[model samples]
Target: MRDTALGAPNGAALPASDVSAAVGLVGLAGLLAWIAICRSFPEFVGAFDLALPAERLDGPYAALTGLIAAGLPMVLWSVFVDKVHTRDSTGLDWNKRAEGQSTRAISFTKLTGLWATWAIIAAVYCIARWYWEGNYLFAMQILGVAIVPMVVLSVPYILWLDRRMFQPRDGAWHFGAFLLAREPWDREKIIGHWRAWIIKGFFGAFMISILPGGFTQVVNADFGLLASQPGALASALIALLFVIDVQIGTVGYITTMRPLDSHIRSGNPFLAGWLAALLCYPPVNYGLMSAGGLLDYEINAPGWQHWLAGNSMLLSLWGGWMVVLTAVYAWATVAFGLRFSNLTYRGVITNGPYRFTRHPAYVAKNLFWWSASLPFLVTSGGPMEALRNVVALSLVSGIYYWRARTEEAHLLREDAKYREYHAWMAQHGVVTAPLVALGRAIGRGRGEVLQPAE
Candidate 1:
């Protein structure tokens, strides 16, 4: 909280986080308004209904309305209010633009690299059988429709941006040079390039795949009826929070534009970071954490709702607490604005829910799982089963802790600013300070020195 603790290099005060709470708030406001219109004015939506392709604005194309509602406002706020385009981090020098021929050459190479990357991702999608099944099928269909437009649009976009880029031979350019065999390229940059794209390609599809269900649930929710039923209300609220998470999270994945000052400076290159993150998502999670999977914690668990059935007072309190946890999880994503992806460092965020803890989402999510699932409260299973369930759930929480450590390791290595933030959090963070001290004490007792990964 002191100026000394938060000082930037040269002993000056650190600037506030790039993305503001207001940005996400405006987006949330827009989304709520859109949802209101959908629920209240079906005829109005149906009249000029081409954009509202679904009868209820809850289908895939219709779900994209939530993106526009949430994303457009965030974009406007970031550009107009935050002036993100003018940030030094964007690597743009508008006053000293490049010469036309140089810009053209650079754009050509970057385009080559970009196109090749997309082609490879597409090929992978085609070859991967999972992408054609279940929810992923919708993602493939959406990407298929957008591929032509994306390919055509990138040409002009690259050319325009290259003219003002301070250093146009960035990761994409390096990769292009390596592929063309026309010039030497940094192998590290090429690896970084692939790492960033691999994250975008993999997570982007998954995010898209899961978007429609929550959007539909929130839009069609019977709030009036849900209000009287504690269990139903909690589920609805949780679904809405998740809808916010998915909508904002998907925006973060897609809007990695330099002008927005939300470009991935580097992907988290640590293999532990990749492994920890990938294990939590997709086909891996399907096999590893499913009903009969290695980490199945819900063996005989019917969840909080079932256990607390007929007890309205207790159910209300528990449900309310669960909502609070889920809100914190959603707020953590909202805090990132247009820069919340897995396994990448777009920028250091030290605002909103982040000010309280280094990993608000992880902490809140783990707590929510424990509370909502109530691993010890199994119906058919007795003490032994309860103990097994608790142990399994604990291991799942341990995985999240592993993820947090890996992320910290990656960020601490990438940016001096992050190291400062880490140090500051260790001393002053609302939730992180105590945990840091406890960790240090435990390490000392074991005669082990635990330092942030360099």
Candidate 2:
């Protein structure tokens, strides 16, 4: 087995690998130190209110000591464990062969060193927490410290065990094999395109962050409601929504990562602009809402009718806008599908909202954010709320313009048909069509009028 896919590029320095390993070890050490020091002082734990009940502390402390004792042997084994590369298939033979292998031995030593350090740190933290009465705090700290190494060790262990138990054949390593096995529709090119846009969307969100503060200030100032009152509940809800949106966005990203990796492997661009847009926009909107006091859900009023009337109209508008944007996104996705396919040379996705605006999903995203801000305009109870809406709208519009430009550039490269699309849009004025047409007409008549006057 050549393992060509896993091999490093020719002439590449191995120093990069060494440096990464060193950094990982250093980080592990730092985390251990932090846990140890924090656990040492009872007063420190008391200051943070981490102290635990007197009766329950001893058992946990004993358990912590036992864990440390048990982990020490594994740590020592890790230190001695060495890798051997040879034509032989037997595991023990490979280990014996690696007895003098410098690189393999060093790697194992480092791993074992870190494992021992982590185990000891965990023991110290647990002991401190149990005897010192900050049991919960100690447990949280221990769990946090344990997580990274657990992940590092568990993943490899499972993979190795799986290989030995089920597929004992040589040359069976396939990156993203799990994803490929599950989703036959997963294509490499589409994943690459989607990943590229994900990066772009994240950058765009960062840009959007800069302008929302002014919008938030304006909205908060105008609403006249005290921050501690009716505004609080609204603000809290807005924040909660933003958090949910971020969590979902993260889920979407995870769901797509493996596919994107596969797409890159196949030298393709998986262009899912609408999907990326939907994932990225909600966070930006939530952040803006929080900044504008719209998320402060603590404040409530007795006039249910007023609240209903105000919020109802805004919600309706938002819903309508969402529909419109969704339609547009669908159209874009469909229209550009062929071009994206030709460029990245990959899969076809014609389901769900795809029948609508080629990029209906992206459009839905735009509508969602825009509509989300409407409550600030109507229920905000002050001028600041109105200002927040205006500012948010402007920022969103700017983001769309930026996104459109990038999307168009990508389209042009992927498909010549995009040139014609651009020309058509220019002619129709797209979003700014009326203004552009008016300008052209005025420019044409002005020359004649000026010549006649002269």
Candidate 3:
């Protein structure tokens, strides 16, 4: 006989086997109910709307009712069973046993089971759709079923895989940790240790560029861009462009950042801010285009759509230019490391593009932003588009002016090196000294010249 006392000194309680049968029955019932609801749902059958099924509301209502009944019972059973197990264990939580290994195993098993069940259901759905509607409807149904779930599942799977594969048992940094760290200053050491650099650069580029764009495109194609004609060719093309921008922009930033890391780390907020702005700007601009109906291929030839398309095209041109310039700069920096001493005053870069102008990159980036606005204007084909472009350009220019001065002052503190470079540039008038002088004047007026770093 089992001991009735909770956590009795003598181990007299019955083992878990006593309750296993009851738990199995409850779990099985819940699973069956959930499957029934999912299989019968109107959303499952009516997704394409190619055919008007008999009894329009029955599928949806039955699914809804089944979902609630199935879900609530399972939740209650699990909770009650857990509570009972805890009580039987003499106030010791059964969840704490075996270092929580049992609970984890159970969870893993349940998740795997659910996944397999869903996969089977999807296969059945596709087969049924093909039989009822035709091959085209079957294809659409498969895509509808697969795409969203795949993306959602990918994130957790990646994290889990990374933890299992890349996480060191020793004290070494994880992959994420290494990516986030500042690059060391020694050029020879960095060049020699090429593997680390490659890994960091590759992952950083993918994260910042490819993933966001690709994800956006996938989501947009799945739901947003509805085709009047059978094939969603136009939506597909725009989605492809978004992916390209992400990849190009990511590579551009990574290359630029590799070269500028040394100078950027030297506490020059202007340079750092500029780099940050470049890194962050593309996504925001793209998002704006998407939000404003520029990316919608279906809504053509009028109002917001026209403006969006025109501005987007303009932005793309500017973006392309910036990518080219950044690529060139990155190549020069890596190829001719530390050779341009005059350019590197107190570890601040002031050569190449810098020789012609204090902030060539800034100018390029500003132009890029302005260019993005151009597409919107051209698509709209009206005066309103031009007016919007003017406002955007003005704002970008003003911000650039403010950031450039702050960067210069930060560079000056490393001693006479930066100051000497500044004086030399001013005297020779190699670049437009007037522009630098004007920036200085504005910076001084705003009392922004000497504000100490926080």
Model 1 ranges with Cα > 4 A deviation: 1-15, 43-55, 449-454
Instruction: Supply candidate 3's per-residue lDDT for 145.
Output: 51
* Number of backbone clashes in candidate 2: 58
Best by TM-score: 1
Note the Cα lDDT for every prediction shown: 0.86, 0.34, 0.37
lDDT per residue for candidate 1 within 1-454, as digits (tens), equals 3434333333333336768888888888887787777665567766767454444566677677777888899999999999999989999987876677867977888888899999999999999999999999999998999899999999889998989988888889998988888978899998999999999999999999998888888888999999999989999999999988998899889899999999999999899988899889988798688888889999998899999999999999999999999999999999999999999999999889888788999999999999999999998869998999999999998888889989988887888778777776766677887876776688899997454221
Better of 2 and 3 by lDDT: 3
lDDT (Cα, tens digit) per residue for candidate 3, span 32-101: 4543433344565666564655322322223223323433443354346533323332223223323334
Candidate 1 minimal-lDDT segment of 10 residues: 5-14
Query: Model 2, stretches more than 4 Å misplaced?
Result: 1-363, 375-381, 420-454
| Model 2, C-alpha of 264: deviation from truth (Å) | 5.0
What lDDT score is found at residue 188 in candidate 1? 93
Estimate the TM-score of every prediction: 0.94, 0.30, 0.32
Judged by lDDT against the true structure, how good is candidate 3?
0.37
lDDT score for candidate 2 against the true structure: 0.34
Runs of candidate 3 with Cα error greater than 4 angstroms are: 1-265, 268-346, 368-377, 437-454
